[model samples]
Target: MGELVYGLLGRKLGHSWSVPIHTALGCAGYRLIELEPEELPAFLAREDIGGLNVTIPYKMDVMPLCDKIDDRAAAIGSVNTIVRRDGKLLAFNTDADGFCFMARRAGVDFHGGKVLVLGSGGASRTAVACARQLGAREVVVISRSGPDNYENLSRHADADIVVNTTPVGMYPGNGAAPVDLTAFPRCRGVLDVIYNPHRTALLLQAQALGIPCSDGLAMLVAQAKAAEEHFFSRSIPDGETERILSALRHETENIVLIGMPGCGKSTIGAALAALTGREAVDIDAEIERRAGCPIPEIFARGGETEFRALERQATAEAGKRTGCILLTGGGAVKTPENYGALRQNGRIYHLLREVGTLPTDGRPLSQGADLAAMWRERKPLYERFRDTVIDNNGPAEETAQAIWRDFCAYSGD
Candidate 1:
């Protein structure tokens, strides 16, 4: 027999991490299928498919195709998973179960507490349902044109809990927040249903305010576990969710490379990108592109202070983008201000290589400069920021491969 084929159905799937979630549950052969509205009908008619998970605009559209939907799915008014049982297509909403799991895991007791829900989309519907199920005192659904929208958000200033189900803080829109958490002084906990950034801007704000906060990663993993139970006809260990979450956390955290001048950060970044299938970005190159000048010219005319200013701006921008292999400049760790932003979304790794073997072609700091003195000056800063050390005394390929293996081990990929 062939392997069981299960997949998530959506229009755009570039940002999905469902495959890893399912695989983490010991289920394999998961696929992601992007279908147009017209393509969905034909695809649904095919019974050969093992299981189909729904997303976005198709969640409601799939109701007619289901033979039956249980009370949980009926109450949520959305179906996220479809499985065949007794020759009938059964639709289920694992999202509801997932939200419950997430709430429990977060130690949030919504009972008799006013809840503020952001957005009025499909995710909002499910979150509202979950909140009500938790016996919330009142549930406020905020939409763009709704009476309780962001414009009139002051109406719910006394809310006890906030749940963001919108895509405002999702990847590519990382720095955006639907509403400021400070508006609700009574807010006890915050949840943003955005898993990509792991630590979203909203969550970060809540954390900064000493409020309990969590990202949608738990809900995602919980929902996948629920779907996996349906797919394989088994219940996964409760501890499995956290195990998977820990892995996903590592996977989403950026693999940041910081090192001395000509320590092969750019080369190692490219190799790591290839080995891990994650995008690699050279911060200095991005800085140069934005400044419209080479590092040498920037130093010659604008001096190191001006160059550091541009570097800081670039680093701040790059820190907001998740899942990238960031190759930072040699002096990236010298400033303490850069550490908080960089650590927000990345795991810093210091690439250490012998000073004699280091090249000095385009780097202004290394040209005619004492390599020993530079390393001596920057070693403490590098040690301060790095989550791990990457020794590149061997071949660049060897160092890259070693980093890749260690990254996977750390991330449980």
Candidate 2:
């Protein structure tokens, strides 16, 4: 039927390895395209492109762009893969199914387990759908914003599995978790969508207390494989799934360092990279590289508003990398766009230290500020955003070792 035209469109194209990986799978006709939101409609009009994969910023937007959405996609309210059937756009969500496949592969039997889910976003919806479909007894959602606010969680809590779909515990810092697991009695398993840090803080803490946990990598690969099936009109062989997953393993689990300025995000990130045998990326450094100037210069030229816009762009670009440690700016969570990207794309960690531990002139934000008051105000926010909290009150080596222990336990590796 002529060469099948398969492609993907998104703003930041740097972190994507879908092209090489998909091509390696023998879908040579597929083409990956990077385009802005404004360019999507025009791109979809092309008869040459048979199907498409949508990522970030556009997963939800593409819903209206489609002629029809599958039931699962309709229920979850998000779409990541689309197929053109008879000149009509057919939308489907592989995320929930992908997560279910991974859970089964990991030997997770949620049939009778009590479940807890963190956050109430797109991923959480998929997780809920999957859990309910699997016959979980109950599923509860926890958020810093309050239970009443997250109606999805309220409807599902008595589940056997606990899933985290929020950005808490992702790299750049370590502190806070989406749900207060302490409140729940016990769960059969903990599932975290944050894969970057390999074993997120939530997973680590759960493991530390002797709970079984799994990261989002398996689900990501499973969904990616499912998407491949849609693009090729055939099932992906089991052997190839293992091969691609193995390649992705080392690439997806890098340390993500986040905290206030001078909290050693960049320095510690480099060291962590060296020790972990993964590449390190400094979001600020990359922004400087792209902006052709230092961060201070960017701020001076465009003000905080402009700098934040640049930060969001940097976060989006960082989200596409297969495996790498990322060090983000102190205020990366201040913007909803950046926060959403972090929630969807990586593990978040918040580096914390007592006011007495500060070096006086080290951090820009620490200047002329009340340590206790600042901590009080920002602690909850950090807790709200992070999957785990690590006390930077100790040596960096000790901190890294603690992080490693948490990862091994959480990932069950």
Candidate 3:
């Protein structure tokens, strides 16, 4: 028959590179399908769909819908990969294998290493099992909700390799690190499975200690490759896989600047572009170019609805341009379509500043306006779209440098 038709079903598990990574494998007809809980069964019933990768909330729920469970998946009590054979659903756990592969590839010596797992969830369990299988001398699970007998030791003193499977240091909360590395002495390695932030607080702390660390990007690529193998019943070319992963990493870590009018979306965006050698696109300028009028005039003549429509179009167009810093209008998040489009190919950074910090004559929109009320109203929307929040109350040049540094760190540039 034709190449197997495979895809994934799950919620929008923020900033996942699953789509690009999977598509890069060149697995013939493989695709990723973002599905709501109610839409899965009907989608699965399709004849052309050969298999699927299930993530997050649907991982456990999908088990009941499977016709058979691989022994390892049953033992692990989770499913991440599924293949359809003779109209029967077979569940498998590629996550464990993926983790093991990544650890080894990263030169982490698991044999006799003292492993510390930072969570007790399904992913943590998989990590613990992988560590043990790789010959870890001891595996300790550390979490506030861990077992009663769990001994929480400082990473500074005890662990050889610390793996964070929890979502603490993930995007939107990139500043919240998982463990205090101050306690752990001379860690050999660290790994965090949250890939969106690429370089998490835990990884940064480890790097600061001169320890070799890795983010979830490699694991994600490995696991996606494994899923592709199952879905296609064939192996993917190694070079193609690497190229796709490189592209995905570059795209996902891109800085997306959002804020209200007079918030320096264009100025700061250009600064960031100059600092990083990346192209910068201002949505409003693009809108103005297309509409042949200024944004305020567009809003005044056609009202907010028409302006939002233009914003959606601008955001969608911006997503198609790679390696560029995108500056969105302050109200872009008000349109789900625009927000979704922006997030499709980039990470969002909310450039925030207190109302009192903004100069009165900054922009046309801020003219004769209630600055405090406007800032307050737009704060929540900006927060919602931000993967990281950078305060713009300081010097623009310094802020640009900081943003550039964080971008380079996040992109592993």
Candidate 4:
């Protein structure tokens, strides 16, 4: 009855977006409560717990602690949303509802289809239950040691839908996929519960295969919306999910620009920053700042290899940042490792300009280098790295604005 404590409960929550999400939904001061296994008991016993959404290791842990459990959560054997009223704790599994919403939004039909869920944890449980409820003819839970494990994924080649509930391709381990999506040629839909990277390796593979795929951001936001409704004892219009989703997408997804040397990446990046009020991070400038000298000095100090090493480091650091304009040097796409670094949180745009029109000032590789040959060599790399291509032959501001329009319209659904 006293001041209510409202937030997400988990073990490690250093990079959670829950606070911003709940705040945007008008849940002022909603915070993250990181606690160890030993501390969970005492924290749950507190008299002031108005509501809390659980995650990871504690989703199942807190179920027994609750005084009452919703039938859906009890049926799923997972409880992620908890509310305290009349000094009694009641738990629910809003994850199921959230998952269903995400799938439906992505046009993933569960009716009369086989669903292959790629984990055995709480999330996997919820996914399985929802898939069944949504009319999935069969649901297979795949775990490491289970009979239907990774070793025998070919058995599920007929799976109509694939849902990843594991953290394999989650942030920090960006490109890891639990299973090769190619194994399931009949997979009509793919959903990953890992939202940080925007696109996971599995989802990316699905995209490449021309399968309908969706990232987990919609699920994350929808789950938060359900949790907020439980917290406030009020209903929120479902449209709010899409609204918050768009805002969060634009705010968290990085706008990365990659191009040949002096193709107006820096200029267009600055223009984008001005129009959007976001910071423009030049990888070249960051390398210079970190090395306490210019890029040419770094190249002079060592060679192209040293400069590339430094570029990799810079790309890695900049890729981790949320909601910024990242301008990469010309040679950034040359490094294969930089793709995962940039794709983790960015929508990369390849800025294309006439090779003859590019300014080669102070560029190590571009200084009297065969510009045509360089473009021919690097064109495939740029094409591989980019989500979209923008022609930079016009004014920088116009190109930036055109990119802004496309980026705004790109709903990674």
Best candidate according to lDDT: 4
From the highest TM-score down, the ranking of the candidates is 4, 1, 3, 2
lDDT of each: 0.84, 0.69, 0.74, 0.90
Per-residue lDDT over 5-73 for candidate 4, one digit per residue giving the tens place of the 0 to 100 score: 999999988767889889988899789999999998899999999899999988899988999999999
What C-alpha lDDT, on a 0 to 100 scale, does residue 152 get in candidate 2?
46
Candidate 2 yields a Cα-based lDDT of 0.69
lDDT of 2 by residue, 244-290 (tens): 76666534544566666556666667667667776788888888888
Report the C-alpha displacement of residue 411, candidate 1, in angstroms: 8.2
Tell me the tens digit of each residue's lDDT in model 1 across 150-269. 888888899999999888867666667888888999999888888767667787688778887777888988898888889879978889888888877776788889999888898899
TM-score of each: 0.76, 0.56, 0.61, 0.92
For residues 1-413, could you state the per-residue lDDT of candidate 3 as single tens digits?
66556776777754555766776676555556777888778876666668788776677778777789988888877888988878788889889867876787667888888888887776876788888888999998887754621354633266788888888866555446777776677568788888766666677667557877777877878888888888768976656545665666765555788876666677788788778788888888898998999877897899778878887887777764556788887778888656545654466778877766666552555778888888778778777667787878777888888887776556543
Q: Is candidate 2 or candidate 4 better by TM-score?
A: 4
- Predicted candidate 2: what Cα RMSD to the true structure? 10.0
